[model samples]
Structure formats: structure tokens, C-alpha cells
Target: MLIPSELVLSILSYCDGSTLATCQQVCRHWQTLIDHYDALVWSPCCERDFQKGLRRRFWSLDFPDPQMVDAAMLSSYAKPSTLWQSLYRITKHWSLGQCTTSFLTNYTLRQQKRRPCVVVGTTQEYNFFTSLSVAQSGHIVRSNPMYKGTTEGRQAMIVHASFDQDPTLSSFYLEDDALHGIVCHYSHPASPWIVTGGLDGTVSLWNEPERCVARTWQGHRGRVLCVSMNDQVVISGGSDSMIRVWDLDDAEQRGSIDISSYLSERHDWFQGVGEIALNGHLIVCAPDTSGPVLIFSLLTGSLVYELKTEPQDVAFTRLCLTPFYLLTKGEINPSNRNQVPIYPNTSSSSTPTVSSSPYSNTTNSGSSSLSSLSSLSSSTSTAISTYALAPPPSLSLTPYQLSRYYNLSSNNMTTFTAARSCIDVWDLQTGKLVYRLVPPLPATTTASITDIRISPNAAHVFACVEIRDNGSRRNELCYWDFSNHHTAAPSIMVLPSMTSSSFGNAWACFY
Candidate 1:
């Protein structure tokens, strides 16, 4: 029996790529039919696979439009025979994380080689990067901590790194009154607007593409620690212990919650609001102290639940929010020394010790010998003697390795909280701990995780670690692939010490 070409194509549309491939091998007639209606059959498949793969890889479905993708596919593969082949290849490449890393070499060179640039009445300020956010259009928007008056230094800039054009950087600045110390900034995925909060207690929304301030709202009474925005509203938390919600259209304060009441319960007067995250219908606020994380309804501004860490002494610092899950960072209470966990060293050599404990504090006297294994002489010799005299390194289960034992699938939304020296992965639906990842430290180095950011797709976790050796400090960026369960060590990228030193308040996001 023979089937109509249109009917066959429609039937193949419902089949996935693998099924279609198998069907194509059945006969030459089937292959001819697939070739003739390649667009009809493969366009849907391309869109489906691209979106599916992107969501799994990046934890985001914010790719370019289908028509734009189709246009690119047609342009790259004009020949009918290679149409689906090119589409599939690109899809596979994205799925496999086969991406190349390109450093902003020019930006780094300009900073290193060039002399200090003077700005605003001889203030000798250099361009300092505070935060980076990627837009839906593939442009990177970076914010600096400098006041708007300083025109000499690169304050805020936007980089267009889309596929259609060569990468270009453009300076984005605010007006006279709009200038302030922008502590936190956010950009919505579906909008061209950028919302930024400053130490001056002002939240300004800027039209990024136009490089102009749309509106400035003075709602917070103190320094704005964090700000989150959606399509309709913007939520900001400040040092005044208040979380204020504002209407995006009118720039008017809609509702305000006095977090001071919430603060008083935990006796956390010193640590005000540290971080605020808004996802879908929920808003999460984390104080700088050991206060429990407060989750609120986005629409009504009512308390929903409070998520507390296992050890009550661990305090939540940073937070990341997805539609279904919330990730937080917890620091061990500085006042409580007894709460610190001691791990035993597993290495064969007694001289070199590894501490799996995340909260292991290194003193200045011991850092010199452990900074670099190669440089064990000179000032480090005395430190090594002191180290040898000290107790053996503690041994504990490595957190990263523990994550491998879980049989959990990536289909559900998972929350990752980096507490003192450990990362706890929780399933949002069930609120059950899935994995606890502890990064293994080198024998010679004592490291503390400074920050952690899960990629938008949730496939990988990026951790900023500070390593101290012999009183010298270095910063390393660690990348952990969550998708591959069998993978052991995380890939490390060493950031320059000079740049890392200047990054007192920094934020990292993956595109």
C-alpha cells in the first residue's frame, strides 16, 4: 500500500528524530518523501529538539524564535540534502555542552597595560565590574559600582555578542539624579528594561537598548541589597529591613513589608536583608544572619513558609529562585566554634593534609606552606614545620562524590543550597534532600566557597572559591556538571589575583 506524500509527512511529524531516522531506512521511497517535505517534517522536529535540549542543558527555554532559527538553518544549509543534517548537528552540539570559552582579552589587556584612568575631578578610578546579566537578545549587560558622575571610568556597559554581528561594547549611563552606587541589578527575560538598585535607596529602571532611564523610584529608606522583577512588578529589599513591591508601569510603591518584625523574631538586628529572589508566584528573602529563609506569595505579599537549615547556627546569605525551587547559601555561625565539623585526612602522606570541612579556617601562620605545593621552601619552611606539628587532616565524605550516588532524574526542579562546606540538593516537589556535594580541597590548600551560582538550565553549578596559602590569596572559579553523575572533579578556572581582589561585591551568571 502506498501513502500520500502529505499524509506520510504529517505522520512523520509526530515521530521523533530517532523514529524518523529508523523509518527513513525502511525504503528509498520513504527517504525521497522525507527529502521532498524536509521543512514540513524537520521544522517541527528542529524546534522541539532545540527547545528540549536547551531546557535540559541550560535550564532555560529562552532561545531565539522558531522563524529566526529556521532562517539561520536555511542560510547555513541551502542544499536540501544537508538541511536536517545541519539542524541536527547544531542541536546535538548544544545538547553536548560543546561550547568554546572566549575571554574578554581586549578588556583585560586594556586594564592591565594601560595606566590608571582618571575620572570626575581627578578621582583615579579604574573600570570595576560588579555584576553581569545576559539579555534574551544575547547581549551582556555589566554594572559597575562607581557613581554616575564618574564619566572617565567604564561605569555600565552593554556588549552585543549575537551570532549575526561582531561583538561590540557600548557604554550605558544614567542621568544626574539617577547616578548612585548600583549595588544590585536585574533584567527581565521578556522585556528590554533593566532595574537597578543603589546604596542611595533608589531603584531606577533603564531601557537597556536605548541607554536611557525610564523611571526612578525612591522607595527604600536605606541601601538596597537586592532587587527582583517580573512582567508586572519589581520587588526590592533594603538595609532598612523592608521588602517593597512596586508597579512596573507607574513606578509607584504598591505594598511594603516591614521585615523588621521578621528580623526581631530571629534576634538578627545586625544582619538586615541580604538577598531577595522572586520566581513566578513566590518571593524568598534571606537575612545576613542565621534567620530562616522567608517565602512569600508574590501577588498578595503573605508569608508562605520558612525554610531552615539543618544546623540552626548556619545562617543563610545568598539565594537563587526558580519557578518551583529555592536555593540558598548558609554560613556557619562565627560565634559558635563547636558547630564546625572536623574531617579526617584520607591521604597516605602524613605531611600533606586535606580538610573536607567547608568551614575549616586557616590562620596566617599556616597559610604560607600550604599556598602552593611547589613553593615549599623560604618563608614556607617554618610554616610547614608548624603544619607537621599540628593535628592530622580530618576525613569526611566529599560532597561532590556523594551527589553521584543519587538516582534522581533531572526532570523535576531541584534546589541547591551551599551551606558551610557542603552543597545540599533538594527536590522541590517533595522537599527531600537529593544530594550533598562537598568539594575536595587540595592537600596544600585551604579553601572556602565565596559564592555559588547554578546555571539557568540547572545542568551545572559554578562556585567561586577563595584559596589562602602562606598568607597569599587566590580566587578560583569551579564548574561542576550536574548532568553527568559519574564525573568526579570539577573543572577549575583560575581568575587573575588582581581582578579578583577588586571584586569585593560581585555577581556571576551563565548565559
Candidate 2:
């Protein structure tokens, strides 16, 4: 017995995609009804499941006109009878870690013998790498230096690689003679604009396709070490112990904070800012292991609060920002006898007292102690910590609105943290520990994870594990699919003994 089409539509509208898929298999009549009104059956579910969540995750990079962005996204899956099909295809592809990789040529290294190279910066859009020799020469010259190339000194090479097309490489030179090398660079995921901090204490913005400097802002007295940006402003930290905020639109200095002066009254010694994370409203600055993590307001440039972990012995290495929380990765100090404590207070003050833990004892804060702590092996004490993006109610109003009130879904979003031989995946939203991926190593062999990167979609994890073989060290690149993490073997790919030139500057991005 077949129900009326009106009744069928009414009944199925309340069901999810999986349920609708089940109903389609009952009979030809039901399948026809399902196919005819596929949009009605899937539109609401798609909006709730995919559209809202992805938009929230990528809110920082989304177009200014969100309605048009929504329309464009929906139009991509506009087939009348295949809306749910397209949604399912995309989700399954990401979950199953079904991706193809093609190696791009190392054009710069191909001309000469392999040299030590380092990755200067990377975003989901592009990867940047440079060799010490090229950086010192202040330019990339061909094998024949006399022959004039299209580009010269202090240049950045851009490569365009797409899934279906071949990669095309080109270079653009910086016009400033004082700019010797690039210390750090950042690429906006949404825009073609690239911001670079140079050794010459100057920051330059470039339009990638045109291969020319759009603007240059000079303020830092020393070389810039870190940079972060959003749609409105660019934030940079340098050896000058100053954090400068620049207006992206006009390339003018909006504000500057002398970190040394900000904390001078409290601590006798303050290291310069090492890394910084800038959302639209808040800035989190990590100076060094000895100093507390300083939180400040972007609008007024006021100190919001200071965060100190118990034991306070961890040397923070990297910081990542999300809409709701700030995450940090560091190495625990084994020399300290106390266990790490979580965030102690969330109040703001002009001069807050540093925590009285043994790690904070001023008497022990000398060069010898610092050098001994630094000499400790990092493999044994690596850890990751999370803190709220803004201070609690008494300190400040909640600056992040997307996650709490808007119902931005944050489930199943995982990030990998490495400690010695094991890698753990944690849910960023809830701070729940999910999976501990252990590399398949021999009992006699000792291994340590050097680096771990998560795919943009958070569905896959890539780890670089180093193992010693007959006194020679080798690196293995391992890939894991989170969907199959519970299985005995979730590793999809393992490339052993990757060469320096081939894999040194490699990064992965999905379309």
C-alpha cells in the first residue's frame, strides 16, 4: 500500500538523510517520490549538518557578504535530485581519507646540490620554503648568474598547483634593497594577499598573481619573528619586544604595545615575545617559558589577564587560535617536581602577581638553570594545553559569539599532539581526548614524533616520526584516517627514509 505523496513528504521531512535513504529502498513508488522531491527532503538536513558548521569554522575567511557566499555554496550542489547525494559524497570522501597526492618538483634545489632547507611558512593555500644559501645571497639566481632571469634578489617564488592541472612556478623579487631574507610569512586563506616579515625589520604585503609588493610598513626595530592576520588587521611580533598592530586596508600602524614596559613592574626580566595569536578582538602573547601568557584586548590595547599554568615549567612552543579557545603546545620540564596545574585565575589587573610555584622562584632564574632546562630532552615531556579565548565574566564579556549562542557545531573536530612515540587526537571544542595513535615500531627501536599536521577538514592526520637506524636518523611520514582509527591498522600511508630535498618543505592541502 503506497501512501499519498503529500503524506509521504510530510513524514519524510522529519527524517534525516540516512532514514530517507532507507525509505527509498522500500518500493519503486517511494523511491520515485524521494527522487522527485529530493531538495525538500535534503535541504533542511544539509543546512543543519553541513552548511552552518562549515561556515562557522571558516568564518574568519568567509566573504563579507555571507548571503552570497551561502548561495554560491548551495549552487555547487544544485542538481534537483542529487542534493543529498552530493552532500554524502563530500562527507564520505573527507571521513575516509580518500585523497591523491602528486609530488611537485623541487625546482630551486634541482639546479645544485642539496642543502639545508627550512619551511618558512605554510597555510592551507600554499607552502613556502627557502634554503640558507638562497636566503644569504638575497636572491635566487639560475646556474648562470650572468644571465638575467625574470626575477632577482629577495624574491618569493609562487607555484600554482590544482587537482586536475599541472603546477606552474614563477618568482617575484622584492624591490627593497634592505630586505635581505624572509624570516616569516603568512598567506590569507580567503584572499590572494600574502604578508611577509623580513630580516630588514620591514613588513611587505604582496598580491600573488601580480608578483609585486602592494605595500610596505616599517616599524619594528629588529627582525620580525612571527606574524598573524585577519581580514581587518595584521599583527606582528619582533625581537624589539614590541607587538605592533597594522591596518590592513591602509598599511598604517594602528597601535603598538611595548611588552617589556607592560610587564616591567612585575617581573625583573621578560623575554621578547616569541609567538602570538590574534583573533579579531583578543591577542595572546607567549614570550618565553619563564613569563606568563599575556592576554590583551585588540580594540583598546589593554591588558585583559595573565594565564599561568601550575608547575609553570612547560616551555610553550606553538600557539593556535580558534573562535572559542586558544591552544598551546609545549614541553614539560622534568626538572620541576610539581605536576602541571590548569588555569588558576581569569581576572584582569594592572599588576598581577606571578604565581609562587617553584618554577617562578626569582632566585633560581639564572642563565645556568635556564640552560640546564633547555638541555633536557623534549621527547619525554611534550604536551598540549587549552585556554578560553576571553577572560570570564568579571574580567571581560565573551568575545567569541559563534560557538556558544549560534550553536556552531564543534564535534568530531580533532587535533594531533605528539609525545615521544605516541600521537593523541583531541576534540578541540570539548577538550576530550579521543584517540592515541601509536606507530608500529619494533620493541628495540626508539621513536619520536617530530611534527604532526591535521588536514584542513580535520578528517586526516599526518605525522613525521624519526627513528634511529644503525646510528643514522631517518624520518617516516605516516598518515591516519580518523574514521578508521578504531581498527587494528588505520595507517593509510607510510613513506620511510624521506629524502631532505624531496620531503623537506612538503605540505598537504585538500581542495
Top lDDT hit: 1
- Full-model lDDT, candidate 2: 0.43
Clashes of 2: 1
For each candidate, what TM-score against the reference? 0.54, 0.50
**Ten contiguous residues with the weakest lDDT in model 2:** 388-397
Report the C-alpha displacement of residue 171, candidate 1, in angstroms. Answer: 3.6
Instruction: Give the CA lDDT, 0 to 100, for residue 455 in model 1.
Output: 46
- The lDDT per prediction is 0.48, 0.43
Q: Report lDDT (Cα) of residue 280, candidate 1.
A: 50
Tens digits of lDDT, candidate 2, 1-511: 7578899888877664445556777788887877788667755644433333322222221111222122222233334355454443334223112222111222222122211111221111112222211221112211111112244533343322211121232233434333435666665334456667767778877665565678888999988877777678888888888889999888679999877765544442345676777766677787743455676778777776565543343233345443333444432223321232321112222111224122123221221221122111111111222221111111111222122212322442221111223343222223332223444444455445445544322333455455555656545555443222122221121111122333332332221
Residue 74 displacement (Å), model 2: 13
By TM-score, who's the top model here?
Answer: 1
Q: Write the per-residue lDDT of candidate 1 for residues 1-511, one digit (tens) a residue.
A: 7888778888988765555556677789987777677667766765554443313221332323233232322332334354653454333322322211111112122111111110000001244334555554435445556534346543453333322222343333444344566777876434578888888898888777766788888978888878888778888889888898888889679898876676546443344676787765667787755566787766677776666665553456546653334555433223322333211112233222224212113212222112232211111101111010111111111222123213221332131111134344433333433333334454444555555565443434555555556866544554444222222232221222224335332222222
